[model samples]
Target: MSPPRVLIVDDNLMNLELVSFLLQAADIDVSAASNADAALRAIAEVAPDLILMDIQLPDIDGLTLTRQIKADPRTRATPVVALTAYAMKGDEARMLEAGCDGYIAKPIDVTSFASRVKAYLARRAASSSS
Candidate 1:
């Protein structure tokens, strides 16, 4: 079987690169987009197994994009995770309410980032099979 695929949407070049490199090292196929428009296009083209969305995009924010992805029948089944710096009170609750399947805080821990991402993918697989 092919390696799992992940799409990361973040306007910050460094964040995007770091996450991409980490996932790649973990043997994931990574696709990235720097903005909402490009992210939408990548989603359609990549059919990513999972999405790591940065909450503050240059265009639409990540929560709004997550809602859009969840609303669409073609993409609803794919898991969307909020990857953001917003760790204040209610931030995670808000993201979950908006439709994110999971959450990952920003300034990610390089040591555990890949495993955490894989955990989400594994959850998706288990849920899909059931």
Candidate 2:
């Protein structure tokens, strides 16, 4: 089987570089988008195993983009995890309602970020096949 592929959509260059580097270190294929429009285009080009969506995007927010992604049949089964700093109450629930498969708070824990991503990918794979 091939290594899992991930799409990370974040406007901050720092966050994008960090996340992509970490995922690549784990042998995962990584793609990126700096804004919502780019993210949508990226999804149409390739169906990734998982998506790391930054909630505060430049154009359409990550929550809105995630909903669009889930609504589209071609990308519905791909797991999306909200990567946000909004750890406030109800934020996670809101992201979930918007169609995120998981949540990862910002200022990510470098040591565990890759593992958490892997967990979500595994979860998505299991759910789809079962």
lDDT of each: 0.95, 0.93
Estimate, for each residue in 1-130, the C-alpha lDDT of model 2 and write its tens digit. 9999899999999999999999999999999999988998998887788999999998889999999999999999899999999989999899999999889999999999999999998898899889
Model 2 TM-score is 0.97
Clashing pairs in 2: none
User: Which pairs in model 1 have colliding backbones?
Assistant: none
Residue 34 accuracy (lDDT) in model 1:
92
User: Which RMSD values do the candidates have, in order?
Assistant: 0.6, 0.8
TM-scores of the candidates in the order shown: 0.98, 0.97
RMSD of 2: 0.8
- Candidate 2 residue spans exceeding 4 A from truth: none
Best by TM-score: 1
Off by over 4 Å in 1: none
Candidate 1 structure quality by residue, lDDT tens digits, 7-83: 99999999999999999999999999999899999999999999999999988899999999999999999999999
